[model samples]
Target chain A: MSDKEEREISRIKEVESTNLARDDIRELVIETKKAVEKDNDLLANKIHRSFLDNNIKSFDIVGAIGAGKTALLEKIAEKLTAKFRMLVICGDITTRVDADRIEKYNAETIQINTGRECALNAYHIHQIIKNKDLQNYDVIFIENVGNLICPSEFVLGTDKRIIVVSITEGEWVVEKHPMLFKMSDIAVINKIDLKERLGTNVEKMIADAKNINPEIEVITTSAKTGENIDKLLELMGF
Target chain B: MKEELTKIEEIIANPNEIKISNIQELMEALFAKLKNRVDNYIGDYPTFIEPVYLEENVKIGDDVLLGPNVYIGANSEIPNYVEISNTIIFDNVKIGENFKLENCIVAKNSSFNFKNLNMKNSVLIGAANLKTELQNIGF
Candidate 1:
């Protein structure tokens, strides 16, 4: 067998080991065929090849508005670079604002301008990574638009979704937007340094979050003061 | 977090019916859905929701009184007592309390207050008071 064929076989085995059902494999094969027909052959290969890569760590950073997500993203980017080949797919309404903001990090950053589009769907993400070589990177970070509602509905085909919540926002944020909190794979409690100043009850906030999602992985950090950043990185598998 | 997201799995498994006869019809249906939500606004509301479309499983919060003739071109939720009137709310809104909104699309906890708000092609978060004067516009 050719190197590519062997790689494909190995990838499929890995996915099977992860408890993917027969129907899942069938759907993937069909999707791969459609992608090959419409997008290109290269993407078809990547989709199939993703099954083989043992270290394709993909995660997302989502949050409500003014939740200190941007600041926290920069700090994470700075730290994640030490151990992984990290890339950031920044989302915005009009232009590349977030992409421009994180330009100093020396990482691959692309601004997926949704224009009038509200959120990023799986097809859109497939289009974004189709032409790029993700083999060089160990991790991909998606800084989703600072909107809680839309991002919750769509899946970007990532391994995990990390929700960034700030102290200044509110304890009711998670309860109000249960979808975002519920969909998250990890919850980052940002801006802890201002917890006392903002009169936020930290334990209460965590408790409220936990009530919404019993299995949520929580990490508290201060993007401003750099508190518990190590814990955040550790959770991210960086 | 994975455990909490199980509800989404059910929604994704059993989605609301979608009928996009054509792209234009889809757009119109989206606008119609959004226009129905103008009664819930709470800040410097803008008119950015007039240009997009959404799928299903969207939710909003209270005190979202929509502004006059506002159009939201997507699927969304408007919770109880969120004051919004005569404004166009966009898709994917999770707004909260004491929001005086009008003439705009309130995005993702983006606030609005005051009267005659003109939010066009801009996203606002916790923004307040956007006064605009257009005689033709009414709640």
Candidate 2:
């Protein structure tokens, strides 16, 4: 064979090998991500089982911004503080405002700043629980970051997952975010006091949530007026 | 208040602490102590513009007022006439005009187009188009 032909063939082979190596690296990255997610789920489940063994009930409350999750939590903490010892873990992209608010109710609160992450994974909860004495509190409430879409994908090993949606978010919010309802154990339609002002159809929204997840218990609440808060506490077995 | 009173009573009952007969005097001392503690805590809070951490390629438009304790992440755009106070705006966020944001955490890649809207103590995720006023004024 000629020297020129051999050199061209070798260069072609080198280019093909480089392309193959790039493809392999991409696949490895994707596989690694999936494996990490699986490990997170396993760790979350183990933590949840540990809590159950200790007879502690934990809840993960998730919702969008301005959906009244923090307000609902404040009401719950205020009502339940007299009877039960509770801990609140407030998750946000940044800032500890929610934790500071919950602390005003005399509950031990921890703030998990997820930085740029939209959801609170099981790993974050695991880190917090591993350091703290979990037996001190009978109930733990994890207020996930103010997001509807991302929190549904990450299960933080809670006994109950509550999705709070308000009338101010528009009537189609439930229909738009069905996965949150499907993953949640209870769906709270908050801000019932603004129903008249917003002209929202609360019943239809609840129906839509139920259609997505039939087993989800739907409740209407007005955190401002303190309506149905007692019923919510009762349902939570406070 | 009840909890505080209980703590004060416990303190009064202790032999190691100073004994006070009048409840009013004890309460006044406790109030002063609380005020001092609160003042110290407030002093620790980050002042606006003191801890302003901006990352790479952040674009701030004309007439934007950034208040204290604000952190603007990488590649975020702050347009004209926006007042942000005690807020953390994450990376790749596109903020529009005439918006007042206080005590907010705006997540990454969120877009906002609003005018004269006051958003306080809120977390904005994804895309938000806030239109507060109706276009047509009824004659």
Q: Indicate which candidate wins on DockQ.
A: 2
Q: What is the interface RMSD of each candidate, in Å?
A: 12.0, 11.0
Global local distance difference test of model 2:
0.73
RMSD of 2: 20.0
Docking class of 1: incorrect
Cα lDDT tens digits, model 1, B51-110, are 222235544443232222344434555444444433345445444344445423344333
Chain A TM-score, prediction 2: 0.88
Instruction: Locate the minimum summed-lDDT window of 10 residues in model 2 chain A.
Output: A108-117
lDDT (tens digit, per residue) of candidate 1 on A133-164? 66777777777877888886566656778998
Q: Write the per-residue lDDT of candidate 2 for residues A122-168, one digit (tens) a residue.
A: 86677567645777888999999898999877888989999999999
Candidate 1, overall lDDT?
Answer: 0.57
Docking class of 2: incorrect
User: Which candidate leads the pack in lDDT?
Assistant: 2
